[model samples]
Target chain A: MFLIIVEKSNEVIYIKITKIAKAGTLESNDILIMVMPNDSGNIELELESIVMQQFGDVIEQVILHKVKEMGIEGITIKAQDKGALDYTIGARVETAIKRAI
Target chain B: MQKLRRTMLFMPGNNPGMLQDAAILGADAIILDLEDAVSLTEKDSARILVRDAIKYIDYSQVEVVVRVNPLDTEFGPQDVDVIARVKPDTLLVPKADVEEIKLVDIMLAKIEEEEGYLVGSIKIIALIETALGLETVYEVIKASQRMVGVLLGGEDLTADLGITRTKEGEEIFYARNKVATVCRALRVDAIDTPFTDTNDYEGLTKDTARAKSLGLTGKSAINPRQIEIIHAVFAPTEVELKQALRVLAAMEEAEKEGKGVFSLDGKMIDAPVINRARTTVELGQRLGLIER
Candidate 1:
């Protein structure tokens, strides 16, 4: 969000997600994120946003970056964005991850 | 010198649109509310959201305030803990009292030391809303070294008093006087509560003017439209500014002539008048109503 991006390292830390966690809302300028455990050893993200055409890639990157920052892997993230900035995106992801763990 | 805080606008903490636009609004300070403005279920998410907004957003040239829940509530501790890490300009403690303020101050001190932030870098503003807090308001303001302001929560204070809050505001008159006088004595900002009716600009101006006359430094605005009206009421009038300038000029002349008292337009001017004029000039300069 601050233009400081870390390399997505190969070392992936996996934690057992015992329950589904969700954060944020569909309000304008907000992004709702839901996290669940996935059996596949890969990170999957399902994204839908009002501004998908303009900022979908950046929003996905922010979510992945935050997930990567938390060293989370083998998890599925679903984000519903309504033009949320990178900070909001990052925060929503962090909150969802915190709840999931 | 005291800062100009004539209009402290209240913005919902969880709304990213409002948070992003807060700085561009003309209020002297913007209060990001995590208390009554937020729902119980959304507390966790709102705290994280507000922290990130403060961390990433550029709120330049305007003071940033965050109103956390009361410590007795479950969310209050986490709110303070998470929000303090971002180091907002000030924390408005609602349902405030001496004991609560002391606890908040202690918590802030520990965080400041642990995080290597300057001890007392984060200021505190007490929201005195209950009868007991009003009775012991002086002690509350003195409880913390970080105390910089006190806001009168009229809605809650009137509810505690078992009285209806009318547009006339006669019910909170005593509370207003007490809070303002104590804040003045302690050299802190005395902020009046928001005038909830957003449609009536005339009523808003009158309410702000009354609060200003009662010695309040500022008034809280529920709507952005109330900001300029509150600021206008607080700014010194053209006649008042002209008279202040004349009194100041005469005071300077008196000082050169080795006298403590002077006269302007056949009227006696003394220490109190001189001090008042100086305060007006300083306030005028702060409001950008006159050239420094």
Candidate 2:
């Protein structure tokens, strides 16, 4: 799945995800997200999960919502889902962003 | 009311998985760590996470404590700033002395004023981790009206004393003894530092026994597995519970008979004995070892 959202940002993006940071666990009903900096100034998402064939779009929407909520750009989010809820995904994204900053 | 604090488990503030389940882990208190548990680079984000956790988390039966950085650090003011807005059950001031505690007290007062919370609603737990802090612990305990307890910081004290840290904990003996004594003198709870060896359950048990013998009300736990042992070690024993019940019954009878003193099994039971019994019963009730 792919997503593209346009928002005005004139400030220079100097701070990036300096390291490979991760959140959540590989446990049942959990999702592990690996977030890193992207050079293309676009939010790139790569998802892998058994449920992706069914709930791929919904999961992408959740990740996109959190990325936009944090005002985060130029980031790559790789989410490995195992039936995690929206709250869990949002929390993981927030933690990854905090670690990146 | 002074709630039970037999086991205060430390959950890393930045770890949402831990924070989300902290209250349900059967600890009497949960300390969200924004200090040593979190790295320097992630301090700001950790504080923000902890602030949101306190606001949103349903910590109904558990007391929530935030261990903020020392006031001397750049993060101290920001930690307090977040705390003022969230208003946790208590603030665990790390590496604290009289001056530092007073500073926190003053800032809490100002924040309470600005935030429109009740003045002195947020309690303070002074963590004595330095030579100076241990030396002046008496003043530190009395520095603020909101003071609830004092905790010994074993690792920091060992580092400050230039001694090797050990599971045996001989190096922190004097500091632990002094903190317990001062806390007793001030009628405050004395909380011991965590036993760092999470893998060694035997060592943790022995350490907790030592802390109980020293008259410390509680000990901090770095892991959830340690909580049950801490609570078990601190629970009122069966014999003590029976004695407390008898003493309370006798006291009530004496009061009804207009008597100030009484004899139980040929031993005198007076104000001090009754007070001790009351404490035992209260502790038992709080631990759920006895009927309320």
Candidate 3:
């Protein structure tokens, strides 16, 4: 099972699912947390941190692409996702990305 | 599997001028890069531009290849949809894995099967730039019979390996050689990495030559100037042509004499030698060294 919490100011989002899981954690000053887990079997992934905060889009794109590129089949990402602190989101995403891969 | 454009010049998918100029650049092929070159904000725009370019532009001699973001990215599946709809000469996917390869193949297959395009009509060129990709090269290569070649993408490879860049090529030689060896064994073309230094013509020449010597069928080009250099290095020299012809003539004589093997220019010629000669001829023609 995987548990995810997305908190944005007064808004909080949480998700929990069960399956084979690959997880990552990204947190920074801008975006608090984003976790991604893949439900696909026959694949193992580890999350790597992304240090740069300014380029969240680039980080996200890289991570997403790396996941698809690595073939993680099915994945569920839980984001304690925040905004503005892209560096944090990037780090969280990279870990999720690495895990998904 | 034919000699791909010596220069597969990359045009940023978001840049209209570059894409327009790319058609006129005389590059054998143009790869409208939707991956590294385009920023995340512009991926959608880039896709539109690429689709427009494919639909409107008359490429003539220039082959069109599109480098979609890796399958792991949000854009990969959509990118394939767009490219497959456009049906460019080839679809370039970066950081491909066996599953991704199968995914792209399945998509392309579904598209073609429904639309009646030949199964292998649209070529697939996988860029090997990750550790997992390197480890799975053999499986990945076999994932698609439509796979025409394997591309060595250096920048990403460096990132994947956590290594810094060096101009000497020493750092990448092993990977480069591995790509070539695998391609050769599978009888597929292996494309060498692009030379990032666009202004260094001499450097480009040397790099192209090195790639040729290392058994790469061709190298990628970030600019038009590098294409001719790659083509020149890939073209067979006059001496090679002479030797290839001698082998062919000797083989013909052997066939006439009902002998399976013979000596050509005091060198032993056998089935492998004859096959090699024929392959050279085919490759020479593809390279435009000989007029078909």
Candidate 4:
């Protein structure tokens, strides 16, 4: 039960080094996402996952859905998965998109 | 409906595995930390992840508490703005500054208005860690209508006092007792600080026992391993439960016999004893240790 006493973090200095951005982690039940600019004009997704056999398509769907929800295109995405849940996948993808844009 | 909060487990805000596994760990509450646990660079990611976790994950088995960073820091506003909309059971405000807490209450009201969450539905817990905070413990407890509890931060309090914290907790006795007593006096929950040495179960037991002896109702836990021990310390023991059952039964019989007090185990069962026995019996029933 907390109220927002707003203090803006001055530490967030956004210096975009390049078009590539990353978020999430390689830990168990997590996914590492990398977003980079691509001239292909379509989302190119590369994925590796521990539970690929059981839920690869589902995990990939979650990633694509989040990427679409953020209204992003013309990027190549690489997600290294360690069996992350749908929420984790969505969060990581959203974070990477924010960082990239 | 006595909420037994013997253990409140703190999971890092950024970790997916821990958050996924947290509810099944048997803690009465899980605190997802966006404070000291997350590094500066990862704050945004952690906050976003935590928001998604609360939104999608079902943490209804236990109370969900989000420990936002100190409101004086920049990350705190977003922590409260985003997480409060998701409706966590409580938000633990670090530092416990009375004025800041008041400001936070104002902001939470605005968020609740925008999100259509009922005003004062979410709760606040004050983290008593500094001498100045301890001084304003009463004010902090009264800062908001949503205030539910206050937690002692032993490491921070010890550091503030310029004293070394011992496994025996010699340095934080006054702060612990003061917060515990004041919280009780204000009719709010008094939660003890986490035992930092996760490896030392025996020390944790002793430390928890000492806190319980001083009237702390529950303890903040650092590890899942500490939950059982803390619950053991706070839960009504079998002997106490049995005695409480007997006391209540006797009181029931005495009531039928038109007696105001009765003898149980050669001791007079009076109002206070009956109240204690009722609490114990209710707790045992809640834990399924006794038939309702």
Best by lDDT: 1
**Candidate 1 deviant stretches above 4 angstroms:** A1-12
Q: Output DockQ, candidate 4.
A: 0.70
Better of 2 and 4 by DockQ: 4
Across all candidates, the chain A TM-score values are: 0.86, 0.82, 0.32, 0.81
- The DockQ-derived docking category for candidate 3 is incorrect
Distance from true location, Cα of A7 in model 2, Å: 6.2
Candidates in descending TM-score order: 1, 4, 2, 3
Candidate 3 residue-pair clash tally: 21
Over the stretch A17-83, how does candidate 3's per-residue lDDT look in tens digits?
2333222212232222233344442222222224334544454554454434444434545343323
Candidate 3: regions farther than 4 A off: A1-101, B1-3, B113-120
> TM-score for every candidate vs. truth?
0.95, 0.81, 0.71, 0.91
lDDT of 1 at B255: 93
DockQ of 3: 0.02
lDDT (CA) per prediction: 0.89, 0.85, 0.71, 0.87
Error of 3 at B112 (Å): 3.5
Candidate 3 vs candidate 4: the lDDT winner is: 4
Which residue pairs overlap in candidate 2's backbone? none
* lDDT measured at residue B76 in model 4 versus the true structure, 0 to 100: 92
lDDT of 3 by residue, B171-263 (tens): 889888899999999988889899999899898889889888888888898877777878888778877877888898778888999998788
TM-score of chain B of 2: 0.93
Candidate 2 accuracy as lDDT: 0.85
Model 1, residue B274: C-alpha shift (Å):
1.2
- Model 4 per-residue lDDT tens digits across residues B1-292: 6467778999999999998988899999999999999999999899999999999899989999999988888899989998998888889999887887897799899999999989988888888999899988999889888888999998998899889988888888898889989988898889999998999989999999999989888999979999999988888899999999988889999999999978987888899999889988888888888989
* Candidate 1: pairs in clash: none
Candidate 4 chain B least-lDDT 10 residues? B1-10
